[model samples]
Target: MSESVAGREAGSGIPARRLWLATTLILLIFVLLLAAYLLLRKPTEVTVPAPVAAVPAPDPAFATRVRQLEELNRSLEAEIARLGRDPSPLACPPGTARRAEARPPQTPAIA
Candidate 1:
């Protein structure tokens, strides 16, 4: 063991521990290089996510128009109910004849 240490010393009689340190560092460098090569052998692909479509905003004008038409229908229904109780001839009178004066004149048949 002493002879091996003496052989490992430099001409200036430096400690042989430097050789062991250098050998250990070289082994560590080779191990790191091998690990890096294995990790980079196959490249991994990373993809960015696609953007989502935006939702359409609700239209207040459309809602307002629908409400107006519905209200108009309700008013017409009320008016019809009121007219049913009236004793007017214009409100579909009972047993009415087909009066020619109330209708458009019939056109004569052309040859």
Candidate 2:
């Protein structure tokens, strides 16, 4: 193969030797930069949050109020059970039951 003075094959603009050298130089620069960054970069400080104790103690009056509300809810539920189906007619117009029309399941199309 005939070599040119610029260290390239005459017809081709890029030289194999120069291309290898340039790529090696670029890679070397990248490695050095990466090493420098790793060496000089500040270490991250990890902070552990102080442990918090859940609501030291619940108030006695608050506990009493909660119990009273629970008892009221139980009585209301019992009263509703005593009376079967919703006695009052639905707000909707007389003939139609207030519900959406049921549609058939659609078959999925094959890709």
* Leading candidate by lDDT: 1
What clash count goes with each model? 0, 0
Q: Cα lDDT for residue 80, model 2?
A: 90
Error of 1 at 111 (Å): 50
TM, every model? 0.32, 0.37
Pairs in steric clash, model 2: none
Query: RMSD for each model, in Å, please?
Result: 20.5, 17.1
RMSD score of candidate 1 (Å): 20.5
Instruction: State residue 50's C-alpha deviation in candidate 1, in Å.
Output: 23
Q: Write the per-residue lDDT of candidate 1 for residues 1-111, one digit (tens) a residue.
A: 988777766543554567878999999999999999998898789998999989888799988999999999999999999888877765545666567669855999999
- Would you give me the overall lDDT of model 2? 0.81
lDDT by residue (1-111, candidate 2, tens digit) is 344554554546547668999999999999999999999999999999999978768889999999999999999998898665556454556675544776655999999
